[model samples]
Target: MRKQTFFLLSLGFLSFTSCIQEEAPNAECDIVTCRVINLENYSIFYSRHDAVKEVASTDSVVTFPVRNGADVSAIALELDITPGATVTPASGSVQDFSQDGVLYKVVSEDRHWSRTYRVRFVPMMVLPTEYKFEYYELDPNSQKYYNWYGMNEEETRIDFWATGNSGFRLSRSSALPDEYPTVPVEDGVSGSAVKLETRSTGAFGNMVNMRIAAGNLFIGTFDTQNALKDAMKATCFGLPFSQKPLRFSGDYKFVPGKDFQDRSGTVISGRVDQPDLYAVFYRNTDDEGNDVMLHGDDVLTNPNIVALARLESPLTTTEWQHFDIEFDYRGTVDAGRLRNFGYNLAVVFTSSIEGASFCGAVGSTLWVDEVKVTCE
Candidate 1:
């Protein structure tokens, strides 16, 4: 009886071991069935139909495995055309797939349309980066202007005029009728002929340092007020003198000790009745109310003329002297006391006043050239 019982017990133990091994195989099969491959960032995965598998019915749970760095952000599921072949998520998390990866069934359904799940990643950050003045040149020909190293052009000319009396003369080679004469220099370069001169008392002084170029005569004068006026009005060689008023002159005789009190030289010399004269050129103003002449007492406190170099010499027909008048129109004032007036550098001219004469004449001349204003 004891032997029989032992034999039965051994048999029972063997049976239990066999059952355990069978259960282990079933567990391994379950794991293998749930295994899934991950795919993302691949464009072909979206249209790849034969890449994935469909398992279980619509109510069954599905699982998938993913590789490292695989973007499962977007998932898609394939649908069979049969009535109940459509997929719907069941118990656990739905099978997440990639748009670029294989499609898998989560839960089965019958619809023919495929469904996809998508997630968008946050976009990367980026900074916006000084503005850069375009240079331009005003052309004398065609009265045009060009900008950006001559890449762009326009038809606008800056009106520039000669100062005093040196008239403008157009060169034969000038493309514009009113253009200034330009002379060719070394290395095929060219320069404009703009001369400045101060004449002696009597003789009409030729523009000092006049240069001829392209069959054009560039001349100027300083000294005789008439010469200056003539130059301002001249249209020599088909070049039109800028009708713009640019030259302004004034005359001031000393009031003996009163006006001459702080002056550097003798205010009144013997046998000399010194008369102060100034000329102004402008596009002739028809407004009678506008004063085109000025007087000594009127300009005594004038700030524009205060700093200009004063010309002091005996006027004669045979000799001419150059007086450089560097004007500062920046000090001109519209209205105010003598000490508080401000000046406009752009508007410069002489004011009209009674009893002021130029070389004891109604009209006189002053020569002007190389008129330049800088905004540095």
Candidate 2:
């Protein structure tokens, strides 16, 4: 398996600490920061302007989204390193990457160890038509982390992809992909698809009243801030989407769990579990001119919402089935705003629709593959 890494923005500036190295007692040598920039314009672009995320962690791969018509032949990058590390393709060094990617090497303070990183730039104008999740070669580190991301043909990680497994991993202890709430499955409609499931967290989750974690996947950021105030709204939804998607088509298989429980962990007698699948296209700005985004609490009721699409009812399937859901337009979309990315869109999936509130069964499972965002 190949080792691939990715980083998406979370909108908040993070404060990072660095180690002091005198070139003698130092053994750690690695790249700390990486991003693309326009030397002439003095602009730093770490996150894509077309996406709604920011770098929230240090383990993320540094990616840059370059707009068309910009200087592409010769590119400049911004990077940082450990105190004892010296990087080649040195900081602010100019290189032509219009044809191929460049590898930047960093030598540790001890001068005995080194690591190399692939510096890449991707176009932000053309959003892929759909996702198949087939290009990924999940690393061992990725297995420990329940999140999965998509990349373009150029191998640039798509910021529009995310899942609920991150929230579940906070309590679950399993490290392998099979133990994760969201993972890749060998059996699918075609190639490998993502397997989503609700699982028990042994004693840790139950002690806190969170008994089961319903599997989920969505196009948004997961904010731990909302975990206490409103766990349902914990996963912030929507992204800067340029297209007015009309229909959503995909293939899925579902098997609901046997016992149903709410956030309180109380049994709901005779209540059959239901899966949730929906999409929302809403304005990215509020009436006050400030930026806006939706969460599970407001994805359906946000005043700026132009349209919404949801599965008609609970889908209980024994085998993979092709399904399509049409977006129900509520209000007109702003033509001017659409071009400027004033509107945001999100598509969400969960084994338990009520999973947002930690309400679902433990054994519920959902397998999704080949998701397409239809325009015509």
**Which has the greatest TM-score?**
2
Encode model 2's per-residue lDDT on 59-83: one tens digit a residue.
3344455555445567766676778
For all predictions, the C-alpha RMSD in Å is 41.0, 12.4
Q: So what's the TM-score on candidate 1?
A: 0.19
- Deviation (Å) of 42 in candidate 1: 64
> lDDT tens string, model 1, 1-376?
8999999999988897776442211111111122223435433222122133333222122333232354555444333323333333421233444443333332224233443322211111110000001122343333321211111123332222222222222212223322222211121111221111111112111233221111111111111222234322222111112222223222211211112100112222332322222222111111342212222233334322322322344242222232333333333322232211111122221111111122111121221222222111
Q: What TM-score do all the candidates reach, one by one?
A: 0.19, 0.70
CA lDDT of every candidate: 0.25, 0.71
* Model 2, CA-based lDDT: 0.71
The reply for model 1, stretches above 4 Å from the true place, is 1-297, 303-306, 314-321, 325-342, 346-359, 362-376
